[model samples]
Target chain A: MESLYLAWRYLVYHRFKTLLLVLSLTLLFFVPVGLRVLVQQTALELQRRAATTPLLVGAKGSSLDLVLSGLYFEGTRPEPLKGAEIERVQDSGLALAIPLHLGFEAQHHPIVGSTVEYLDFRALEIEVGRRFVFLGECVLGAAAAKELGLAPGSTLVSSPQNLFDLAGVYPLEMQVVGVLAPKGTPDDRAIFVDLKTAWVIEGLGHGHQDLSKDDAAAGVLKRKGSQITANASVREFQRITDENRDSFHFHGDRSAFPVTAILALPHDAKSKALLMGRFQSKDETSQIVVPSKILDQLMGTVFTVQDYIVAAVVLVGLSTLATAFLVFLLSWRLRRGEIETMVRIGASKGRIRALLLWELAFVLSLSVLLAAVLLLLTASQGGALLRHLLLT
Target chain B: MIRIQDLSYRYPEGGFRLLLPELDVARGEAVALIGPSGSGKTTLLRLISGILLPEAGRIHVGDQDVSSLSESERRAFRVAGIGLVFQEFELVEYLSILDNVLLPFRLHGRLRLRDADRERAAGTLQDLSLGDKMDRRPAHLSQGERQRVAIARALVTEAPLILADEPTGNLDPQTKGQVVELLRTKAGEAGATLLMVTHDHALLDLFGRVLEFGEEEGATTLVDREGAQ
Candidate 1:
């Protein structure tokens, strides 16, 4: 006990040296453990979301990009599949098709245009107001709502694809009707609207003033027996409301409209295999992908990279530990006079050894405790941090 | 308090030897030893305090046979029965003056530290005019004050014998005299036998007798206060 007391006093007297040693040891212990915990948590989060999503159908291109864009609403927007694919999947009776129209942004948040079934498929519940019920209405994810500081009755304007293109996609103002509850997933960072609204934002659908009205006669370019054509002076309705909602219409064949992907949920194993086999033909323009399989490949690469990182951290930790040992040894050398003094004063050999050992034990114990606390923080919050990193 | 008969010691490297025929000091005697450098004045103090064992003969301090005791036993005896004061003070710089004084009790398992021991240490520093400086480290003290702290450490043990080797060697002339006088007074007040080695002849008057070592053959001659050898 007395030896411990002396050791404590020695450490307290040289507090700066003690603090430096402790911080070095803390990093040495914390880095590898914290890295492992974060990687494991990221893997688990990715796997959980991917496991819940049965399959993804999109244009014939990068399966990984399609999965990432369809599931996470992140990364490159894949080549789009036609809206007719949803009808084909529905007619097959092998799966339920949920169409996704992606590739638009509102306030930097991805605008995910899907049917109401998409929300039910993902088990998303509204936290405020109600879901989008009109063509120009949007529902914000919890994170998006908090980020844009918008609630029900607030307005959000879609960002124009190109600021300088006068005839390009125009910014359409949409009304915020609801906010979704947070699920700690990518869904929490997206803005959801009806599929037609996304097409409207893409300049594929629009509303315009009625050229048949008597007040708009000068703007009409030509008039046939039962049809009329208007020039550029005609005003296009940028917002859809009760009075102008009926004016919003699509110009082309509706079945040919583009959707980024379709989430296919089959009834059983046979149904899933049949649906997967249907797109296996080389002549098929679209590909069907199992999300879990793609995610498994992704996690495999992540684990390999994590292994290298952990190895590097261990090597660095070993060197740091060696340096810490050298520091303690040099410190012991500097304290030779003090040790000699203690010896001459009748301090026993056992007591002297105990004093040194106790000091080392104190430093080690403190480093371990601090490292544990940091690892706990990483374990608890690492998923959310990883999600934010992957999304942005 | 100390007895040596026909004692002989030689350094292992072989240049010097100490041969003492006979020596005796009564309990409570304050004696001074003077010699030239390497004349074995400090060596004799080490021999009597059991810090060094003679090559030939026996040494007795109080009732214990110091030269015959084993190494561990000798260390226990040294910590419990002899108070040592060194020229450099040798106080642990990290410890305060009071902890330095209380150090002996903490070193050996035989001595259990108590509240009374703390009070006695405090009192010893108080008597040395260091009551207010108990919490100060040795580095913060002047040379005389540091030496006094060493003296307080030696006195706090309440040992039967006090062996000081040039306790004032590093002090100024005025501080040297004052330190020697304080050591003598403290040893007398505690009833401890004082055997101090010094090269300073002026302070010999403070002791009952002075033994001066001869440079030729390590022989010693006793000189009383009248300067008669």
Candidate 2:
């Protein structure tokens, strides 16, 4: 205890030196600890999301790309399989096969065109208003709503994939009819739209101006609105409403329409194996990918990198310890006269050495405390940022 | 009691050597050692206090042969037996004067300080007219005040032997007399033998016995210690 008291007095007397030592030591430890936490936290988060996604079947070009596009709705656009593929998967007596059509964005958030059943599949709940009921209506994820500041009755415009393709699909202004609860997943950054509305956005289904009443002489035409003025030049209805609900139609074979991928969950292990066998092919038309297995391979790479980081941190820690020891030795050497005085005053050399150790222990404890605080701050907020940039 | 027989000590580098044939001081005696600088007056005091061992002979303070003990054992013996005052007034600069006085009591197990120790330390400082400066550190004290603090620390332990080496070296004449008087009074009260080395012959009348060391010519060394070369 007397050793401790002397140590305390010395540290308090040389406060600036103590602070400098603590700060340097803390810098030496915080970075590695923070990176380690980020790696573990991200891995656990990614694995949890993969478990929720049972299996994803898409074009066989790249399984990684297919999984990224299908699960996150953000990646290279995969070759679209015919809609009948989803019907065949459903007919196989397997589990449900949910279709996804994602090739557009709104206010920089992915606009996912999927069925209402997808919501029930992901166990989502509406926090405000109801889901889409009309052709061009949409629902908002929690983050998307918070970012765009849109509630139930706001309107937003969908952006196309290729701006230079003038003859391709144009922008569609859809009504935000609902908002989802915050789920801390990639779904929280998407705009949910009906698959048919996605087809409408693709220019496969649309409502054009009627030219049945060719009144070239009168220079006017009667429309859904009670009154009609000039400037009735033919154009598309950007929004779908009950007044013109019947005017929308698709052109050709609906069964052969394109969808990006299909997310299927089998009922049992036997059924899942059967579905895998059905999609197995050496040819590169399409393939089945179990996201849980694929993510194991993905995280394997992450673990290798984590191992290297851990090794480098170990080396840095060793050198830092050496530096700290050298500093301690120099300080002790400077106090040789003081130590001699202490010995002359009946203080044993062992006792004085113990006092020095106490001083070092106090400094190290403080550095660990500082590192813990930094790790906690990063752990609390890293998930949101990672999901936004990588998952979403 | 202090006893020295056929004692001889020399530096490893072939420098000045000290050879004391025989000396003895009875308990509770007040003796003064007067000599020019480097005549081995302070060296003899250190050998008697178990601080430096002789190469040839033994020094016995009380019943223990200080030269025969290991370095650590000698330290414990010295802390229990002797109180020391020095020229530079070696008070720990960071500690308050009161804490410096109580330091010896806290450094070892047998001399562990308590409330009674605090009261005694306070009483010693009060006797030196330094009770009000107890909370002031050594840096804030004057030279005379710092010397008084050193004396208070020495006397607070009530050890059997007190050794002072040029304790008045940095003080004015008046302050020097006051410091010497305080040391004499405290050592007499504690019934401890007092040994002091000083150059001032005017204060010789204050001691019961006075001993002057031999001249510098009789002390031989391979190197001229006084020369710059």
Candidate 3:
């Protein structure tokens, strides 16, 4: 006890040196452990989400980008598939195709356009109010709701695709009908709207005042045999409401409307193989991909990278340990007089050694404890950190 | 009290050897040993304190055969029975004056540090006129004060034998005289045998007996100064 007390006093007297040593050792211990934990967590998270989402169908481009955009709502937007692809997959009786339109954003959160079944398929539960049942109505993810400070009955305006494009789609003020419970997934950060509302935001559909109305008479350019052409002065609705919703219309063929991807949920193994086989043809314009397979490959690469990182960290740790050992050796040399004083005062060899060992033990124990605390904090916050890394 | 018979010690590197046929100091005697440099005065103090063992001798301090004791036993005995003071005042700089004084009790497990030990340490510092500086480290003290702290450490153990090797070597003239006087007075009051080695001849009168080491036929010889007071 006395030796320990003396050791403690010595360390306290030289607190700055002791603290530097402790910090070095802490980083040495924490880096490798914390990195492994985060990598494992990221791997598990990617695999779990991808496993739950069985298959993805998108334009015949990068399968990785399609999976990233469809599952995580991140990465470069894949070339969009036609709306008719959903019906084509459904008619084959091989899978249920869920359309996704993901090019729009409101308040920096992605606007995910899908059918109401997307929520049920992903097992999302509404925490406030009801799901969107009409065009221009949106349901907020928990994080999106908290970030945008919009609850049920609040309105959110979509961001314009290009602020400089004068003839581009105007911003749409969509009504917030509900907020979903947090799932610690990409869904928690997305704003969900019906597919028609997304098409309206894309400027493919719109609501406008009747050209025959007397109020709009001045905005009309010409009329001939009940075919009227209106000039740009005609008022177009920026928001869809009960009173003006009937005025909204799409001018193109509905089947050809754009969808970024389709989540294909097959009936069973045979259906999954058949659907994948259908898209295997060289001339097929759309490609079907198994999400888990792509993610597994990605994780394999991540694991290899993690191995290199751990190796580098271990090398650095070795250097730090060597430096610390040198510092301790120099410190002992400096303290030779003090040790001699103890010896001449009848301090036994064992007691002298115990004093030195106790000092080292205290430093090592503090470093271990600090590293453990950091690792636990990383474990608890790993999901949010992975999301930030993946999305950003 | 100390007794040495047929004592012989030689450095292993082979340049110096000490040979003493016989020596004795009665209990409670204050003896000043004066010698030239490398005359084995400090070496003799180390031998008496069990810090060094003679190659051929029987050394007795009080009733214990110090030279015959094992290394660990000698350590325990030294901490309990011998108090040592040095020229450099070799106090642990990191420890406060009071902790320095209590170092012997803290160093050896044989001596259990009790509240009484703390009070004795505090009282020793008070007797040295360092009561208010008990919490001050050695670096914050002057040369004289540091030497006094070393003396307080030596006295705090209440050892029957106090061996000081040039305890006032670093002090100014007046401080050196005062330090020697204080050490003699403290040793007298505690009834301890004081064997102090010093180069200062002026302080010789402070001791009850004085022994001078001189070369005789290439061996060291101790001559008594006027037999005794």
Q: Per-residue lDDT tens digits of candidate 2, residues B1-229?
A: 9888888988666677887777888898778888767778888888887778889898989999999999888888878889999898888876789988987876765688889889999999998998999988899999999999999888888899999998999999999988887888789989999999889877666777777776555562221111111
- Across A255-321, the per-residue lDDT of candidate 1 in tens digits comes to 9999999999999999999999999997999999999999889889888988999999999999999
Give candidate 2's fnat, 2 decimals: 0.47
Worst 10 residues of 3 chain A by lDDT: A383-392
Against the reference, the lDDT scores of all candidates come to 0.89, 0.83, 0.91
**Residue A157 in candidate 2, Cα distance off native in Å:** 11
* lDDT (Cα, 0-100) at A339 in candidate 2: 73
Residue-by-residue lDDT tens digits, candidate 3, A281-354: 99999999999998888889878998999999999999999999999989999999989989989999899999
Question: Where does candidate 3 chain B have its weakest 10-residue lDDT segment?
Answer: B220-229
Candidate with more favorable, higher TM-score: 1 or 2 = 1
- Ten contiguous residues with the weakest lDDT in model 2 chain B: B220-229
Deviating ranges (above 4 Å) for candidate 2: A15-41, A57-66, A69-95, A99-116, A124-262, A266-288, A364-392, B1-6, B12-15, B21-32, B55-73, B91-98, B119-149, B168-193, B199-210, B215-229
Off by over 4 Å in 1: A103-110, A140-176, A200-258, A283-285, A386-392, B119-137, B215-229
What is the CAPRI rating of model 1's predicted complex?
medium
Clashing pairs in 1: none
Tell me the spans in candidate 3 whose CA falls farther than 4 Å from its real position. A147-150, A159-170, A207-244, A390-392, B126-133, B226-229
